[model samples]
Target: MEGELQRRVGRNLRAYRQERGLSQEAFADVLDVHRTYMGGLERGERNLTLRSLEKLAAQLELDPLELLTERRER
Candidate 1:
C-alpha cells in the first residue's frame, strides 16, 4: 500500500538528506515546505504529489527514481 511506499521513500530521503548534512529545518527551508510537513514526510505520513516529488528530487539533484528506490538488505 501507499504506507509502505511512503516509508521507503522517507527512508531514502533521510539517507540522502543526511549525506548532504542538512538538518530537518534546513531541508524544509530548501524545499519551501513547513518543518512539520517535512517531519511528516520523513515519517512517511504524507501523501506525496508529483510536483512535490519532482521538487524533492531536484533539490537532491537526483532522479525521481532514486528517491523512490527501496534499499535492499544483504
Candidate 2:
C-alpha cells in the first residue's frame, strides 16, 4: 500500500538526514520544501513525487537509489 511505502521512504530519509547532521528545517530548505511538508514526509503522511525525491537525493550528495535503499542488518 502507499502508506507502507511512505513509511519505508520516510524511515530511510530520516536516517539519511540524521547521518548528515541536518535539522529538519535545514534539510527542508535544502530540498526547497516547506518545513511542515518535510515534517509530514518524515511522519509518512505525505506522498512523494519523483522530482521531490530527486531534489532530496541531490541535497544529500547521494544517488536516488541510495535514498531508496534499506540498510542491512548485521
Lowest-scoring 10 consecutive residues by lDDT in candidate 2? 65-74
In candidate 2, what are the lDDT values of residues 17-36, reduced to their tens digit? 78779999987887788999
Clashing residue pairs found in predicted model 1: none
Candidate 1 per-residue lDDT, tens place, 1-74, comes to 74898888888877876877999999888878899998899999998998889988998788998888886642
lDDT of 1: 0.85
Off by over 4 Å in 1: 72-74
Model 2: per-residue Cα lDDT at residue 70: 72
Query: Which candidate ranks first by TM-score, i.e. highest?
Result: 1
What TM-score does model 1 achieve against the real structure?
A: 0.85
